[model samples]
Target: MKRWIPWLAAAAVVVLVGGGAWRAMAARQQQQKALAQAASQRAEAPMQLAASELVGVVRRSLVLGVPVSGSLRATESAMVKARVAGELQGLTVREGDSVRAGQVLARIDATESQARLRQAQQQADAARAQVDINQRTVTNNQALVNQGFISATALVTSQASLESAQSTYRAALAAADVAKKSLEDTVLRSPITGQVSQRLAQPGERMPIDGRVLEVVDLSRLELEALLSPADSLAVRVGQRAQLQIEGSAEPVVATVARINPSAQAGSRTVPVYLAIAQNRGAPALRQGLFVQGLLDTGRADVLTVPLDAVRTDKPAPYIQAVRDGKVAYLPVKTGARAVVDGQTLVAVEGAPEGTVVVSGRMGQLREGTAVTTAATPSAPVAAASAPATRPAP
Candidate 1:
């Protein structure tokens, strides 16, 4: 009975081991089948992209421009100052008043000048009377000498006295002329035709020689002083045209390059280029000291271009995500001048063809060689049983 019990136990252990091995084999087969299924599904699935996420490359005629910023200034401006010193009697012109050349802008006290002129005139008259008396005396002496009533030496003395009197009269006349000029200077006049920008003196205020009285600026002819880098300056030339975007003006003002500084500015490498604004009817009125931005047209050429936002420049070599044969491909590109067309900034590129399709935005997670579906033709939904063997035609 004991031997029979041992055999029975051995058979029971064998059966238990066989059952455990079969369970392990079944689990391994299930796992293998699941992995194979997953791989097949992934291979058959197509990456999908919406139509709104794509942009097409196109050829465009780009007018290359160099960007510059500066301020607008009057082409002709002057600081009107007091040429002669006097009490400011009245200022006829104020700031922002339009004035013509030789217009009386201010008046000074002319009482003192008038008095000096009168005194000089009186002196001149006295000198002239004295000269007349000397001439008569010389004439009488000559007659007396001719009649043998006077010596030659006496005649010479009379002639010398007459000459001295004539010299004194001439000096007095010169003084009178000076006084008259000083009186005329009492009235300050505008040297230019323009609007008055500033008023520095008031009526009844004492002014010194060359004292500032007013500032006049010709706004009709305005100019922009654009500062450019060394490289950009080399490309600029006189007579080139540009468009100026002033701070307050809604429309861009047209300008022409009038002059370029021969040398760079002191303490900096920037060069000053002056652009003269063209006055056109229906254009916004420009004022001095207004900040402005400009685009100087350097050249124009036809080139393959794409939307500015489509190109990625963060990498050492710029690149764009281009789709080819239903896959996203990373294409390296070299970019050049940029232009604004219809309010969109388009950049000139050298690599891609004109009809290439590229991912324009929202490319954070996109990878190279990623399968994709065009926004125009979306991929079919995954079937409940199995994925389609072939993708649908785009």
Candidate 2:
């Protein structure tokens, strides 16, 4: 009985130990199952966004410009020069003085020219008197020849004397006419209605040859000359609407393309185009020789444009993120016309609403079906409000 009791005690100890090991293994398995279920739920979770990550859209007027740039110049300018060598006795006008065509401007010394005129007149009178006296002699000599009181030789001499007097009178008359013209050339006059920009001669100054007297410029009308390449010139045409900013004017002046050069300069490959300012678009302040910059509206264009900030270009191709169905989705878009508004150019998107919000956040980092609640971007301005050509020059 003692041996049996010892064996039973050993069996009971082994069974108890086996049962304890089993309970421990079951508890470990239960804990591991719970951990796995929790991990699976976490893997299927959605991402949330911070409110501060968004930016606002700015709208402005986007003017399509076919920019052709060049300088300005006066339409009519003449460098007046002295016609003959003489003393600049009298100068009537100063620089900036307005003058008319055929108006006398200056005078030169004419004492010598007057003397020549008088001398020629006296010679002509003497010749006329001599011809009168010779005519009487010729008449008397003819009668004497008929009466046999004079020889034929004497009659021929009388006729010759009358012819000589006639020739001398003609010669003297020609010299007198020349002297009269020289005397009249002493005073000068303006060629056109314009302001004298430069005064090159002074009183008592002797001018020899074609001496420049003054420089006159017509400032009433102005022309703008623009130099552009072949392709650009081809795009713009005559009579197209053009907008330009004249130097020193905060506002821009309006003009129209007056002329286009069909042929281009060979070496520069540039064409010279002219723009005439519309009178209604300006005041007296806008004069000639004011440097200007301009753009021509080649034609009207229809295009879809969106704020550049709403579109992301950090990638190889341009794309925008859109919020749909409680989530953020990476939408691939093809971009088109780009126009500047408040210094931002909107990249065009297809089939998009007129004022749609493209996710400007780091949504490029987010995948499709991401849980998102879009907070509106700050409201700023509409781009068309700031259009460049809306207002006329003041």
Candidate 3:
């Protein structure tokens, strides 16, 4: 009986070991199957994206233009200068003060000018008295010659003396007029209606002829002068519109090409173009010398286009990611003019047909032939539905 017990125990141990080994093998097989199933589901699953991530290539009017940037300037600006040399006085207007045309802006000391005018007037009076004496002498000589008290040649000589004195008197009067003009110039006046931008000369300062006093600018008419290459200038025409972004301004201002310089700028060979601001209620207030940059719309064209960022250059050739047959397809494209339209910059493309769906570069790079679907589609379901939550008991 003891020997039989040993054999039974050994058989029992063997059975227990075999059962455990079989259970482990079954569990391993189930885990492997689950993993394979999950991989298959993942391979079939499509990448889900938001509707906004997708953009359609469309044929639309793309604004064609060249970049232009320059400083703003008032169309009507004047540099007030002193016409005569004297002491500056009564200069109350400072920078930003409003002025009217012909308004008295300042005055120069008139003491010297007044004295000169008096001197000229006194000289003219003395010359007039001499002219009167000459006329009387000529008359007396003529009377003597008629009475045979003097020869006719003596009357002719008296007439010549009278003419000479008259010429001197006329010369003195001309000098007096010049002195009067000089006195009037002492009072400086604003030549145009505008706001003072600079006050160069202060009261009690000595000003010379042609010395700068104030700089006034009319803000009503503002323009930007941009230098463009000769090739770009050839495309720009008067009345063509552009949108400009001014430094320190939040809103963009619309401007029109006002004029084009006939001759190129020296040394640079760049043509200068003037752009006049188109005033509107919503536009921010602008000032002179503000830096502005924008695109000058030279023309427009209807072409297939996409967001400029979508044109990827990572490859040797420029290409865009497009969804065709539910898979990502990279299509090489020839890029043309780029412009801002509807506030988004678009580049003209030639490879993609109109109405083809394309992905934005914001989505990052996507692999070719990868299945893609929008969140609105029903292709993707929860993985738990297909994945085994628990393995069968082994």
Candidate 4:
């Protein structure tokens, strides 16, 4: 039994040594995995940059356009006035109230005119009675003359009286008709269906002929009147499309050019153009009398463009990025006319070719030979092959 114990003790030592070696191998494998993970983290550090944000560009028509500024106004407007002289008994309208055509807005006192009309009618009736009496007398006198009972001169005198009475009745009838019209003219009625822009007269005030009492404007058909130079006006044609931007609105209202004045303005050297607004069909951002600026889309061409946010202006020179060989470089850009594409304003670069990488938003942190990771950035080179061509020194 003592000899077997020695052998068992040796076997136990061997098992312990083997276990220690296995643990060492396991620890080495773990350390290797940890090192690989650390390297991956280092490589991913550049991607942590919040400066690399993506931006979009706006797409628009290639036709050249002339920009103009203008104000909105109603199509129909009038200064409603009083046509007859009388005291205003009732005024039914106020400023900013809507009214229909031929609606009564005020009433004038017509009591005196009514009485005059009655008097004229009474006079006409009396005249008719006198004519009848004259006719009877003329008939009787003629009969008496024929019978030799009345003189010839008496018959002639009776006929003259009858004619005079008839003329008086005709005159009285005309007078009564005139008085009826004068009374009707006292009611001040609206000549159009529109809103009241101003009210000048009140109840109980006497107005003279042709005195203005209210100002009205029609809002259904509104116009955008833009003043542009004669040369610029030539670029715009009737039926062209127009977009209007109201203050504080992100989206704009669309309209169409309706008319253009052929002649230039006297003092401003400008010509007037009108746009008809489609308010009911358009978005709800538009309203009457809204001051706006406009863009006239004149249609598309293939042009070199970059993301609006990608273009950087903070550098020593305004520029964008050119990526190659896993690194990015700055290229100075000369910009030209701006156009909107896909709701983005793209500044046209003179010589920048297509496929150039523009450092989009927050590009201030990037510099020459900066290592960049475009694996996540859209439309960017996944793996660059070589550096970009350098601008030749002067």
TM-scores of all predicted structures: 0.76, 0.60, 0.75, 0.56
Better lDDT candidate (3, 4): 3
Tens digits of per-residue lDDT for model 4, 215-279? 88888878899987665676678998777777778777777889988788889988889888777
Model 3: number of backbone collisions: 0
State the lDDT of candidate 3 residue by residue for 166-268, as single tens digits: 9999999999999999999999988889999999988999999999999999999999999988878878899988878888777988999999999998999
Question: On residues 63-93, what C-alpha lDDT tens digit does candidate 2 reach at each position?
Answer: 5556755666567777777766789877978
Q: Which candidate is the best by lDDT?
A: 3
Best by TM-score: 1
Better of 1 and 3 by TM-score: 1
lDDT for every model?
0.82, 0.70, 0.84, 0.71
Residues forming the 10-long window of minimal summed lDDT in candidate 3: 383-392
Models sorted by TM-score, best on top: 1, 3, 2, 4
lDDT of candidate 2 at residue 130, scale 0 to 100: 93
| lDDT (C-alpha) at residue 262 in model 2 | 77
How far off is residue 211 in model 4, in Å?
2.5
Error of 1 at 39 (Å): 9.9
Number of clashes recorded per candidate: 0, 11, 0, 10
lDDT of 1: 0.82
- Can you tell me which runs of candidate 4 are displaced by over 4 Å? 1-63, 119-175, 285-287, 299-337, 342-344, 347-394
